[model samples]
Target: MFDKFLSIDEEKRQRVINAALKVFAQKGYQAASTNEIAREAGISKGLLFHYFTSKKDLYLYLYDYAVKLITETIEQFVDPEERDYFERLKQIAQVKLSVLNDHPDLLGFQKTIFFEDSAEVSAELKARSKEIAETAYYRLFADIDKSKFRPDIDADRAINVILWALEGMGEAERARHRALGIDLDIPYMMEEFDRYLELFKTSFYK
Candidate 1:
């Protein structure tokens, strides 16, 4: 499914990333193998090694790509600029759910890092992931002036709320998928999200 991602240049790097994303997204970090990734990429195993020295290397490469994709999704599209900041927060929640829908296995891969008792994940990957997340959070936080929000609202606490919302939304969806043995019905999810966001708007916004 991810062939043609092994193109031979910088452009191809993005292709490799997409290919890696597909593989890692499907098999996850611990179970994913370099040979399998290479086969999926339509490249020889030796060529895959030439591009990424080890399974860990390919994983970190894809992890960086994922961070950029998630961060950029928030920074650019989550809250359209013409909207109120708190309303934009609702948009952020919706956009987060959309991203999770497109990449359902992402939560599983992410959970592996926090819950795994093994050493499949590298320390560097975790640190870099944290760095990207913090930068994105600060960027989103800067979008709104604290004074403009509810008098009782705390900016740092709000940031924590955002983190909780994003992660929890994904976790909840993953749990539902496991329990039901089917993909999440995202249209219904968005409908419920809009209902709650409206409630938040009514109570929390001036």
Candidate 2:
């Protein structure tokens, strides 16, 4: 289905994807209008269908593309030698932010997709969400050096707590930004992550 899309100029292909992403992020699969997407991409509705047969197909295609993009980005920038859990996480966040620079709607759209209640896409999203949860976080900490943690501390528990804190902080940041009608600044958020991680290390490190 994407063969025709692939044959197009790279910039044009991305324009379509970005246009679809913006609409999907705001309206989700059930309510997103292909007419709106085509207009946003500066193409006709007929051309959009020529590229993607249906709204469902477009949503799934974009979902797969976004997931692959982020997974590849993380794999490239997250170093295996960075055994410090917090440092590795910081590196991962930075790389994710870099990706967000080009694909502004990706992260938010993904978050929405995972929790999307539409029956049309719920099963697929649930499966992908499970697959990601099983592989991603487990791999990140699989070879972490536990000795750096205090001898009295439970290493796994400490790692879990840190992960929870980071996730909470991210959600809070998104919520705050939404409430204030401000755009998310990746560097600003990274700085906040650094401050929290440093304080956490002071308390937890040997």
Candidate 3:
């Protein structure tokens, strides 16, 4: 689907991708301007369109690219053999933080996609988000050591609750950082996340 974009030299392709990610992350879908993306990429609008037929195409392509990159990075770093659920989650979080630090714009673009309400792409984004969430849940949790969970508790339910709590916490943290106009403080965020994991472990573990 992106043969033209993929065929370009790596440096040029990355420039376009980085520029588009920055614009979309900063201004969001509806407000993001192709002209600005082109300017930032050091290319003309016509050339940008030559690679991507429309802004929607470029946005969706970036979504797929960012998700694939992040997922692959996590798979590379996370220990598949570790069966302790909380420990695995912590490892995954660490991997994600490292990726975010390396590609801040990619993470920002993903965050924008999460809250995007644009009519042009909202439905598709929601569908894609659901698919990704389902896949991630299975891949990340399916092999966990359920025996460690409290015998009185439903392991599946407890796992879902833990995931939901952590997800809500993440959203709240991001909102707070955005409200303050500050970059994510990785150490502080990880410390708080660890505290939450300890609480969940106490509640759910045997």
Highest TM-score, which number?
3
Model 2 residue 78 distance off true place after TM-score fit, in angstroms: 2.4
TM-score per model over all chains: 0.66, 0.70, 0.84
Alpha-carbon runs more than 4 Å astray in model 1: 1-8, 73-80, 90-119, 122-129
Summing lDDT over every window of 10 consecutive residues in candidate 3, give the lowest-scoring window.
177-186
Q: What tens digits encode model 2's per-residue C-alpha lDDT throughout 1-206?
A: 68988899999999999999999988878889999999999999999999888998899898888877987889877888998887887887787777867775886676466446688888877687567667875776788788899999998888778877876887788688767867566678788999999988998998
Model 3, runs deviating above 4 Å: 170-189
Ranking by lDDT: 3, 2, 1
Report the error of model 2 at residue 32, Å.
Answer: 4.4
Q: lDDT tens string, model 3, 53-163?
A: 999999999988988888899888899899999999889888887897788788788768756768999898878877887896568778989999999999999988887
In order, what lDDT does every prediction score?
0.64, 0.82, 0.88
Collision count of model 1: 0
Candidate 1, 70-160: lDDT as tens digits: 7678777764463465666667766766776677555444444433323656677657756866777566756465565578877567556
Task: Score candidate 1 by lDDT.
Answer: 0.64
| Worst lDDT 10-window in candidate 2 | 107-116
Please tell me which model should have the higher TM-score, number 1 or number 3.
3
Output the lDDT of residue 12, model 1: 60
